[model samples]
Target: MQETLACFKAYDVRGQVPEQLNEDIVRRIGRAYAEAIRPGNVVVGHDIRLTSESLKQALIDGLREQGVDVTDIGLCGTEEIYFATAHLGVGGGIVVTASHNPKDYNGLKFVREASKPISGDSGLREIQHLAERNVFEATAKRGGYQTADLLGDYVAHLLSYVDITSLKPLRIVCNAGNGGAGRVIDALEPHLPFTFITQNHEADGHFPNGVPNPLLVENRSPTTALLQSSNADFGIAWDGDFDRCFFFDAAGNFIEGYYIVGLLAGAFIEKNGPQRVVHDPRLTWNTIAVVEGAGGEAVQSKTGHAFIKEKMREADAIYGGEMSAHHYFRDFAYCDSGMIPWLLVAELMAQRNQSLAEMIAARAAMFPCSGEINRKVEDPRALMRAVEAYYAQGCTHIAHVDGLSIEFDDWRFNLRSSNTEPVVRLNVETRGDVEKMKQKTEELLRFIDG
Candidate 1:
């Protein structure tokens, strides 16, 4: 067995198939996870990837070998598995998905009861060690496997999060990117008044067009063009496994996730009446401004699903968001979902009688950002230290919540290393000054590249 750090990410197991991750490794992970959690019953689900079924079966075999009963939810998204785990009140759950990675890639995401994420600090490191060691004490009797379809309950739970009955007729374009999101939309469209112009709605493991990741500029074109041509109110797209979602306005412009964060924060605040909201430190001015303006509290947290979920539970926040399109909800046990954001956004539009662009236009000018920029560097920590040293001299405030973040009266920026990739992500925002934001972003990029 080869020892590689790539499979051990901050949150879940992920790697290129048959190299860092394969059937043998996945089976071992299943056994190890079963032993670690020692759940009497475990729920498992898979995406549309070709390898998903095989990997899931191997995992189930390992779990059963350890006398852990397995409940299989076939061909579901990550959030569905989370729903199954919580709704069924099971011991824990695992999702068999690489989540927006290439088809040749596959991985697993584990959670304890109520879909609580498993991290390195929690139980992931132990699982990794066990998986690498490839040794486990066998049980006297093997566990049994049972199949269940929880899609109905999952869909109902999602709809209950938003008031669709009061929504007006709104035309929207949905680009599933040919992933697992299409089925959920199909089930919900009949129950709502909104008209959906769907594209790439098929669930294809090959991802016929490209990977489902909306962060890539190239992936936004199809959804943008479809929204423009259809003159839809707005458009939404999801990555593979449909955990995170992105939105596009009626003008076919891709709205930054930060703006959506503010929108969702405001919506939740209006309904829930000024509660706490959690946001990642990388991009937070808009979120903070919105939450504070609405008489709510804005709590900053480190970037990652596990950290955000933990913060949400601790703060009892109504909602939380990361700039990378991951939105977490208190109602969903602090689990991120690709399906819920748009539902609430649509409801906000219907209730306000305004278009999505109109609602976000005012906030857009309050804080213009250069979007996240990534740089491949040799020493991420050294570069971050240098940037912090440069900015700390004159900045009014600085923080190391996740990485280096410096805040001046008029501008602020955060530079952090990726947990799963060999790169550093830099995000800079200025108080409605595009030129300054651009200049500072360039300066930081140069420093990182140097």
Candidate 2:
């Protein structure tokens, strides 16, 4: 009997190193992926994690054994694999990255042709099943492997989204948190007119400071402190793989990702004129208002990269943004990038001659929100149902796109259970009513805990 693999998740592979994810398992994954997807050629890259390189080599060996040509772009962020896959016209792409997970953990993210995500709904389940069975027919031909440096092209593609000449000489703070973003920043520095103050910028798998996760409030201290001390116009922080980026205002205020979503939606509309903007259903008021106000259509999708990307393709949206700081661009193969967002926001600041805080103030005030709060509960589904039963009568609108989202005339909230844990996440917002938003949040928490 074969030992079952536990690293496979709903959308990707993630688990603790050595125990759940070892070289052998990754090698099996490569063979399974090749057999299931049957890609003639694949782009493979790895993050700065200590184990990533070895795991990637094992994966390459398995793929090459199965006659799958490999294009290795070493030591890259997750977005680079997406870019290389679409840019090189490869059959598939895989990036070995855990993206903000603890140092003991690692994972892999995958994309197929055109840089489309490979989630459970797509081919991830099949890949996981095949890997578990650990059976592959021997191939006569061994696939060739080659190394390519596409950094120049990838940087060029990122710069194409903004007007280089229009960027102002603003001072900015960039905190890479010892992740993979610093390399890309170094490459982009020469092309822009901004002065950057970098902290924990080097790629260190040991994570000298901590895991490169900006979502946690505690993890944001370094970036905020640096922004204030340096007197920079704004601050930006990225996750381990740099696929998601969070922002801070000149005042050292961490701006919520929801408002950035609105800002980008409006910017895209102003630039391209009435294009569809896809957004997650978790926080809808601000995004919907901004999109429609700019004469663009706002299409709501279930939260997650796979769903958002699929919705973007279906609507041919110019851009899509999730409150989690994942911004997707149509030009970037409908894939999310941490770099493109700041570049575009910088251009907007330059063009409007306004600070990031000034631009976001009105929208944020108009739609005050309580950022996501997570709670560990015995039955997340039951809690959500009880909350829904209590509020359903008063809510003017209800949606089940990703979870339970109930909307009243002036206030709304979304409650969803985590896919991999026994935790439920809650988000609340009120139209121009901070007190109401706070009150509703407290009420919900009390009820949820009760």
Candidate 3:
């Protein structure tokens, strides 16, 4: 009730555990969410974080107090909660997870009926205001709580993306990063022909091997080392909550999410012809090329799950992808799934008889990129203004759907501030030229630093 908790982020709830997100605070959030969304029943789930169970229980207490039936799916990922909300006929869903945050941190992701995300522009602001007000009306009937296991259904849904029998025996290194993904992997193993070489595979909120963010170059060594030693076909790593996934080729080379977006776009476009594929603005040349080449239309949407999902649904697109490794499927109720992307990638490779690296190499050559670079700056707005002023003279085009996207004759770049942090992110891509991309990336960094 103290001037709105800082944990309420633009997309979801995330903050340091106990310090910023405690049982009492989460309980208030639960009640506020029920009031704002007015769900008859809500599905609740938690990740492997140590504080998750306690926070979930407190949230359930608040929801039940508000006469909202609570369906508890214990120790699950964000996607699992999304699945439960629709599959179990729950009115809404909440997931207690901080994703790639530290062990001392935790958060929550919310969805309305049919797994529609509730973000800042949607209903999160109202929930924040209500939680801060901390006033609630008593209901005539208090709702009861129940537990359900939706793992089998969730796994079955994931397998629906791939032709299981056509998939050849694959040697895969799956690093769950000591999170909830291992449980899903265990559930899926019996139904597949994959030999999983796992590392830090156990669910431990303590994060013994460090947070499982493959985005951080340092956190990638474990999977890289293990994959090389195991001689696996390819390796995959997921964040704490397992909503996003990172890939490493058979040679233990980390593949950037941008190329994966192109690969996945091509796969979807191949099967679902003329289907629209939504993508984020950052590092888009590759994806656009793939989508158009496959006879599908490419639509650009702002980054973030909420924006992409809404745009995908509006376009009735078959698939949407972000350079950050979040892949959304129209079939998966338009929710992003880390599980489905990998399965699709595996199938694409098998059907095409190509290695993961080989599949990416063709696209990489067409649209080489600088990946995404982040830096802390005092005034991101001022920096972007300077960038525009500097490049405006020769720029051929500029788009600001999510941020500043400037295109010239042979190169383009997008510079934007992080939605959740103070850092400014820069992405540079050149048309079929890697050296130009590298040169432009350094040039932009120098200007930003200055």
Candidate 4:
């Protein structure tokens, strides 16, 4: 109990197991969640983490004891709980997962009705307070529990995003990083025409292939190498909870997620009507141009799933995409799905008769960018101010949606401090000049490191 349960983060709860997080702490959190939300029924699921089972059990124990009926979907990704929560008309849901953190770490993510996230600004803080208090009223009656299989319905929902039969039989590389995504891929295999060349395709809680985060350049190696060796069409890699997915093209080149935002925006705009598309401000010129060019309205929102989901719901947007590889769908109750983006991309390739590389190359050339660069600093806020002040001399445009985005003659960059880390994130892009983009990025890096 001495360990600071600083486990509750800005977006979700994540901490080292048994110390900051354990069965006892999770039990309180579960009870606190039930007490705060007061749902009659709730859905729960867990990822392939070592402590996930015990943590999930503890959470269920608290909920059941508090007279909240629990429907458990064992050993699944985060999105499955989201789907089941909204689809089943449950009061709320919780998924026990660390989501790409180190093996020694574990956490929980919760959602209210319709699978909407219960972020700190919403309800997570109240739950955290109640849990930290460590006191709860005992319920006289205990609720029932049941195990439900949602794989079939979830798979059908995924397949419904595109015309599966019309998709070409392309050999694609898939690296699940030994996370919970492998099973879902296996389930979808029989229904698709394409052949999957899978790697680390097992449910190993130990994370034998390292943490299942493709965002790290090191983690991209397995998929990139396999894509080249197998001569596959394209490849994808997912994080532990399988909520964020990254992509590699035919030549095994890692595709910056910024471009994928534009790609996904186009597909959603063309398929669903000319509707609002929410985008984060880190790297938005590409997304805005692509969305508006396709007759869809592009709206800017602060980064993070909770913010993006709230904006999408308010705008009634058909789709919302973050340059960080999170894509949200209105049909999915405004929740981000790691599975839908790839499916839509595959279908777009088939319908447009264009290779993944070729289709995106033109857009990439138009908006050459420095994919989010992070820097550790003694004082991140001071660094952001210094960087912004130095660059604002002759800036043509500026925005402060998520951070500081300043534009000049032909280049623009955003420098923002991380909410969770003592680091500053920088993103620079030029209007078609790679050299200019590189120069600006280097200059900004010097300022950030100073």
Candidate 5:
């Protein structure tokens, strides 16, 4: 029998549960992964989603059938799987998570040795095709399965990224949105000097407050409200799997992820001295300026974790950041992490004797950006082409790195269509001209709508 795996996305497997992604389909995927990559030992973990456990077990069954040993790091965030894959020297790893998707959706993210991503052009396509064919050779010996607790080691590693003694006794607000991040926070609380005001700190699969996506404006209210009322230094929030983290200042303002990228880039250069940093093309001006000013090289890559990580390795970049809140570290085998960014930011604040707002305000003012605006169109490709044609004149530069990025002397914009939907995403920035940035954003939207 053959099946069409609609859950297989360009980067990983994601779909609505039970229908598009169920235990049977996941089992087939596991067998396919084992056959395609032929990893002898694999690490697996799951998020707080209700169906993740069962699906993980089904996947393990498939791996075992193909004689692949499994190490179940039960109930962990996606980064933990990445860490364990590289730390424990496993052949590969997978995490069962939908990562801020709605209640009924679940998925899997895969990585090969050294925590390298297995995306479309990588081994993912082969796995998808093999799973669709649904044929696997039976092995004489079944693989072993065991559980490991690497929390202490993981937390220690997280702490290694920052100088703990340099961190001040700052009060920070952390909202996990009832996801896996809170667990890691709890583990790190005893080790750090800062006081953590935690919200929705428990791991709840039901997600009563809603899906744990900090990108949604509504999801941020709880964290921002708590931060303002409690007089905390700053606030941080995470999505379901806690892979990407969002930041809020003491004034209860959501710091745009673009500025954070520049901040992190500068932090890396300040610490490591003129190293390369990777950034997505969606928003580039501020990052380039910050990197060059700090005597570092700024490298641009297509907007995705796989691409960023691959580019980081090629350039031996010390750090990589995307405006979507994903922060990648070279020390972590070039994988993205939600926990590391906040810690580094805290250390940066302490070292500079500044607040989070104080550090970001200068850069945000220098590069005012129209945070990614999305519009659904009947044909996103056509809309992209139309936007490109409309803006081609008076543009000093144009590139289709990940999308249609058009640049002028004082302002620039990147317009790209979504991979999975008929929606186009637009991002605009200017050379410290907020009004111009706003005007151009509105103009681009009107054109896109037309």
Candidate 6:
């Protein structure tokens, strides 16, 4: 058997199919998870990957073999599994999905009660060790599986988050990119007062257009073109498993998730009145400014889903956002969702009577940013240390929250290595000076490459 610890990632279990993440490994993980958490009942869901069903069945068999009751929520998104776990008050949950990876890749995301994520520190290491040893002690009494359709309740809960009754009947374009978002939107459209123009809405495992990751400029073109042709109020797209969603303006301009983070933070503060908000350190100025201006506390965290969720719980933050498009909520057990951000943004637009572009554009000039750039590097940490040394002498502010972040009088930049890939991610922002931002970005790139 392939070692399971090699496949266990910072936030979830993911690897190449059949080799690193086969049926036996998934089954072992399920049994290990059951034993570790020892929940009376566990909720299970799977995405639209080709191998998802088989892997899910293997996991379920393992759980049942260990005498743990399983509540199967078949054909659901990642967030839906979170909802099922939190709503049912189960001991924990597991979602079978590779989440925007190629069709051949598949993985699992495990969570404890209340849909809390299991990171390397939070019980995942224990599960990994157990699975690696294949030492799950099965109970003599076998457990049974039960089926429940929680989609209706899930939709109702999402609807309750927004004032749908007061929403305007705006024309919106949604590109599911042939993922699992189509089913949820199909159920949601009937309940809301909005016109939806959907493209690639079919849930196809083949993923004809790509993996549906809207972060890539190439993957966003279809959704932008659809928005332009339809002249819709906005366009939304999701990743393969519909865990994180992205947005486009009425004029087919793709808005950065950082801007949306500020927008959502402002909205939440407006309603809830000056609560704490958690933001990752990859990009921080915009979120910090918005949260502080709204009379809310801005807490900076390391860049990862598990870290963000833990910080949210600790600070009791009303919301948390990552520039990578992950948005977590206090009400949603601090789990990220692809569906919730759009709904909240739509409701905000309806309530404010402003275009999505207009509202987000107001902050664009205030916090000009170079966005995020990734580069292949041989020595990421050495490069980061070199940059830090270069700036530490003259820098007024510096932090190593996730990676290296340095601040001068007029400009700030963050250079961090990706946990999953061997690439250094760079994000630079200036005090409304585009030229300075570009110059600093170029200078930093040259230094790193040199």
Please say which candidate is ahead in TM-score: 1 or 3.
3
TM-scores vs. true structure, each candidate? 0.97, 0.99, 0.99, 0.98, 0.99, 0.98
Q: Which regions of candidate 5 deviate over 4 angstroms?
A: none
Candidate maximizing lDDT: 2
lDDT digits (tens) for residues 1-450 of candidate 5: 577889999999999989999999999999999999999999999999999999999999999999999999999999999999999999999999999999899999999999999999999999999999998987999999999999998999999999999989999999999999999999999989989999999989899999998887777888889988998999999998988999999978999999999999999999889899999999999999999999999999999989999999999999999999999999999999999999999999999999999999898898899999999999887777888898899889999998899999999999888889888899999999999999999999988888
- List the global CA lDDT of all models: 0.90, 0.95, 0.91, 0.91, 0.94, 0.90
Q: Show how many residue pairs clash in every candidate, following the order shown.
A: 0, 0, 0, 0, 0, 0
lDDT of 4 at 30: 92
Tens digits of per-residue lDDT for model 2, 20-56: 9999999999999999889999999999999999999
- Cα deviation in Å at residue 445, candidate 1? 2.1
Kindly list the per-residue Cα lDDT of model 1 for residues 131-245, writing each as its tens digit. 7788898799999889998888888999998777789898889999889999999999888998899999999999898889999887899999998799799999999888999
Residue 349 displacement (Å), model 1:
0.6
Q: Which residue runs of candidate 2 sit more than 4 Å off their true CA positions?
A: none
Question: In lDDT terms, how accurate is model 6?
Answer: 0.90
Q: What are the per-residue Cα lDDT tens digits for candidate 4 across 1-450? A: 533359999888999999899999999899989999998999999999989999999999999878999999898999999999999999999999999899999999999999988998999988888888877778988988999999999999999999977899889898899999999999999999989999999989998879898888877877888988998889999998898889899989999999998998888888777989999999988999999999999999999999999999999999999988999999999999999999998998899999889889999999999998888998887877887788889999878888898998889998888888898888999999999999989988887766
Worst 10 residues of 5 by lDDT: 379-388
Clashing residue pairs in candidate 5 are none
**Model 3 poorest 10 in a row by lDDT:** 1-10
Q: Between 2 and 3, whose lDDT is larger?
A: 2
